[model samples]
Target: MIDIRDFHVRYGNNHVVRGIDLAVAKGECVGIVGESGCGKSTLLRCLVGLEHGWQGHVAIDGKPVGQRRTHEELARVQMVFQDPFGSLHPRHRIGRALSEPARCMGLPHGRDRIATALEEVGLPAAFADRFPHELSGGQRQRVAIARALIVEPPVVLLDEPTSALDVSVQAEILNLLSDRRDERELTYVLVSHDLSVVAHMCDRVLVMQEGCFVDQLTPEDIGAGRASHPYARHLIAASFPDAA
Candidate 1:
């Protein structure tokens, strides 16, 4: 559903994402794993139009991104950012936040859609009336997920969706995301630094380093001890210290 070819993103003279070529098929969950400063987040931002001033071809469902499309055109590709607290509005109630996206998209706006989104994210209906600060970290993240899913976009770019939560809460959110993907048949490009998380959530994994894709591995590579790239081995070793 998404294709990026020879994508290069730079800030002044410092290039962050260099020559990234990747494709994500419909209903496929592709994980991009790398350490901090590897440009994983930058690539996600560029794909969703948050970062401009880059050179590359990013196409979603055969339509090219950037000046070729309007804001509404880009809405088809939504993003779920890492930080739930910063992503949501402090003053607006959860209901309003969830409804605003649909309203912006000119879709139907009512309790039914909002309720369904909340339930789909494993959130209680009553929480909709509360503000973001009033909810726990997990609830806030769920609200963020609900907000993204409300648009019913075919592809969602998740930027470290579980990084901010505790392990148990992260598991819940991961399961929730997995269930949503299966039920809705949504395609995802998940950016994470955790190899184990990617192992559990993604069908295929892309290892990135210094702003480029260094290796691509299937779950079987991880299972059969076949990831042999230097950086891939480093990541695997760091992920399983006892085994190393």
Candidate 2:
């Protein structure tokens, strides 16, 4: 459902994402694993039209993403950002954040839709009336997920979806995401620095370094410690010290 070819992004003179070519089929969960500054998130932002300096072809659901995307086009792919607290305004209630996407897309914005989104993320419908500050870190992230789902997008790009939460909370969020993907038949391109998280959630994992993917690992390869590239091996070792 998503395709990119020869994609490159630069900030001034510094090249961030260089020559990224990838394709994600419908209902597939693909993971991009790399350390910070390796350009995983930069590549992701480019796909969603957050970065304008990118050069290449990006098509989501057969629609080429340009410098500016209309509300309807953007609703085709939703992004769940790294920071949930910053993503949501301090003053706005959870309901407002969830409904804002529907409002922008001219879709029906009502309590039932918002409440269903909240419940889908394991949050009660009543939490919609509460503010972001009133919730814990996990609760805040759940709200972020709800907001992403409120648009009913086919593809969701997750940037470190569980980085800020505690371990138990992270497991909960990952399980919730897996369940939602099955229930909604959603496609996901998950970006994270954790190989274990990628292994647990993704069907295929792309190992990125220096703004390019050095190797790709499937579940079988990861399980057998068969990463071919040096950087990929190092990442797998770091994620599993005892196994290393």
Candidate 3:
């Protein structure tokens, strides 16, 4: 549902994402894996229209995305950012936050839709009335997911959605995301630094380096053999500290 070709993003004079070409099919989950400062988050921000001033092409489905589109058109693509605390409004109730997208789109607002969305994200219906500060980190993240999913966008960009939580909480969130994607038949482009998390969630993986894609592999590649790219191998080694 998304295609990027020869994409390059620059902040001031420095290019953060360099000549990236990627395609994500409908209902598919793709993971972009890299170390810190590898431009994964920058690329995702560009897709979501947060970062402009890039060169080359970024197409969602078939329409190009940038600052040129209407707000409603851009709302078709939603993002779940890494930090729930920072992404959500402390003053806004969960229900208001979850309903804002639909309201912005001029769609009919209903309590049933809000309840369903919260339930789909593994939160109780009553939690919708609570403020962001009242929820735990994981719960807040789940509310963030609900906010993103309530729109029922064709593509959801997940930028380190579970990176801040504990391992058990991370696993629960991952499983919830996986189940929701399957149940909703949603397309996801997930950015993560954790190789194990990527391996568990993604069907295919792209390994990024510096500012470009260095390797693309299936889960089988990680299971059966070593990654061919030096940086990919290095990342794998670091993921298992005993091997290093």
Candidate 4:
């Protein structure tokens, strides 16, 4: 339940995201993959209202998402950024970070919300007392995910959700995301440079290059290493060099 038409973003003369059209259905997990400076994350920032200086259409579920979003609208959509450690404040404890969204949205049951969010993300309830530095890399990411879902948003924008974690921890986080999506019927737009990560989590993959989509691949195509675009093929080779 995201719709974009002719979306474009520019920083001075540099048009980072140019003339893009995309639609993601409800309860669908779609991934945008590309190299650095491809505008993949820039597009995501625009979706969640972080990048306000954008042109063209951007609507969520039916309502247009402009530079300013209402509190209710923001509560309906949330984002999980790439670096969990950096996203969370070093001074604030876990419980405060998780409950802040619910508080801002004026949602009740702050304690219950924090507790349930931690549980849903496979974290212990006592984690609320812990600080970010005290937790491992994976735990920090879990806290980030829990923070995103604490407000019970329908659409979640993920920016390289697993990139900061170790391989073993990355798989755990992926499974948790899949399970949470099933339980909540979430609509996710994930951005990552890793095709394998996208293949495992997304129903479809959009290959982006030079600020636009060059190709679209299904999970099957990604699994089979059948990339149509040269960029997509290169990505496959880079991610799995031995197999390629």
Candidate 5:
């Protein structure tokens, strides 16, 4: 459902993402793991049309993503950003926020849709009446997920979806995401620095370094501490000091 070739991103002289290629099948959850400044989030920005300065061929759900996306194209893929509080409007009620995408896409029955979206993410429809600041961190993130799913997008780009939440809340969000993916058969490109989160959620994990994908591993490989590249091994060692 997603494809990219020779993807490169630059901001003037600093080339953040260099010559990266990726393909994710429909209904597959792929994880990109790396340290800070590794260009993992940059790749996602390009796909979501936030970083149009990128040079690459990015296609989502069989449509090529260009500098500006059409309404349909915008609805084809939605993003759940790293910070849920900042992503939502501080003053707007959750219902209004959830209805924005459907509104933009001209989708009908927005009220009912918003309610359903809330339920899908384990939030009560009544929460829609509340504001972002009125809810807890996990509740805000759930609203973010509901907003992403409101339009019924085929692909969702998650940038450190659970990173900002408390450790206890992280598992709840992950489980909610897993259940939603299974129910909707959604394709996900999850960018995160957490190795354990990636291992628990992704089918295939790509180790990234210096703006490139250094190695690819299955969850089994991560569990067994099998890493071929030096950086990959280093990452594994840091994440699992006790692994054999």
Candidate 6:
């Protein structure tokens, strides 16, 4: 469902993402893991149309998308950012935020759609009347998920989705995402530094370093500490220090 070729992103003279080529199939979850400044998130930004300066060929759902996208094209792909609070408007009510996308797309049944979206994320419909500040981090993240799903997009890009939440709540959010994917048959591109999260949620893991894909592994490889690439081995070892 997603194809990227020879992708490169530059900030002035410094190149952050270099020659990336990747393909993600429909209904499959792919995880990208790397250290800070490795351009993992930058790649996502380019895919979701947040960053326009990237140079590459990117095709989503078999259609090439330029820097400018139509509402229909934009609605086909959605993103759940790292920080829910930061992504959501501080003043907007949850219902308003949830309805905006559909409203912009001229989709009907806004009220019923908002209720269903909240329920799908394990949130009470009553919460729609509340603000972002009124909800817990987990709740806010669920609302973020709901907002992304309300548009009924085929592709969702998650960037460090559970990193900001408490550890106890992290599993719940991840499980919710997993369940949603199974129920909806959605395609996901998950970006996370946590191997445990990647292993739990992704079918394939791509190891990125210095803005390039150095190795790829399955969840089983992560559990067995079997990686051929030096950086992949280092990452696995670091994540499992007891085994290392």
Top-scoring candidate (lDDT): 6
- For TM-score, candidate 1 versus 4, the one ahead is 4
The list of candidate 6 runs beyond 4 A from truth reads none
Pairwise TM-score winner, candidates 2 and 6: 6
> What TM-score would candidate 4 get against the native?
0.97
Better of 2 and 6 by lDDT: 6
List per-prediction Cα lDDT, in the order shown: 0.87, 0.89, 0.86, 0.90, 0.91, 0.93
CA shift at 132, candidate 4, in angstroms? 0.7
Model 3, span 62-180: residue lDDT tens = 88776566776577788999998999998999999988888887765578888988998889999879999999999999999998888778889999999988787999999999998
RMSD of 3: 1.6
Q: Which stretches of candidate 4 lie over 4 Å from their true place?
A: 241-244
Listed in order, each prediction's TM-score against the native is 0.95, 0.97, 0.94, 0.97, 0.97, 0.98
**Cα lDDT of model 2 by residue, 1-244, tens digit:** 9999999888999999898899999999999998889999988787776878889888998778886888877888889898889999999999999898889988878999888888889889999899999999899999998888888899999999999888988999999999999999999999998888888999999999999989999977776777889888888787776554
Over the stretch 1-244, how does candidate 1's per-residue lDDT look in tens digits?
9988999988998999898899899999999999899999998887777878789888888777773457566677789999999999999999999999899888876988888888888787877799999998999999998888888889888999989988988999899899999988999999998877888899999999999999898877765555768898788778876543
Tens digits of per-residue lDDT, candidate 4, 20-130, equal 999999999999999899999988888887778899988898888787889988887889999999999999999999888888888864677788889989998899999
lDDT ranking from best candidate downward? 6, 5, 4, 2, 1, 3
Error of 4 at 32 (Å): 0.6
- TM-score, prediction 3: 0.94
Off by over 4 Å in 2: none
Count of backbone clashes, every candidate in sequence: 0, 0, 0, 0, 0, 0
Error of 2 at 61 (Å): 1.3
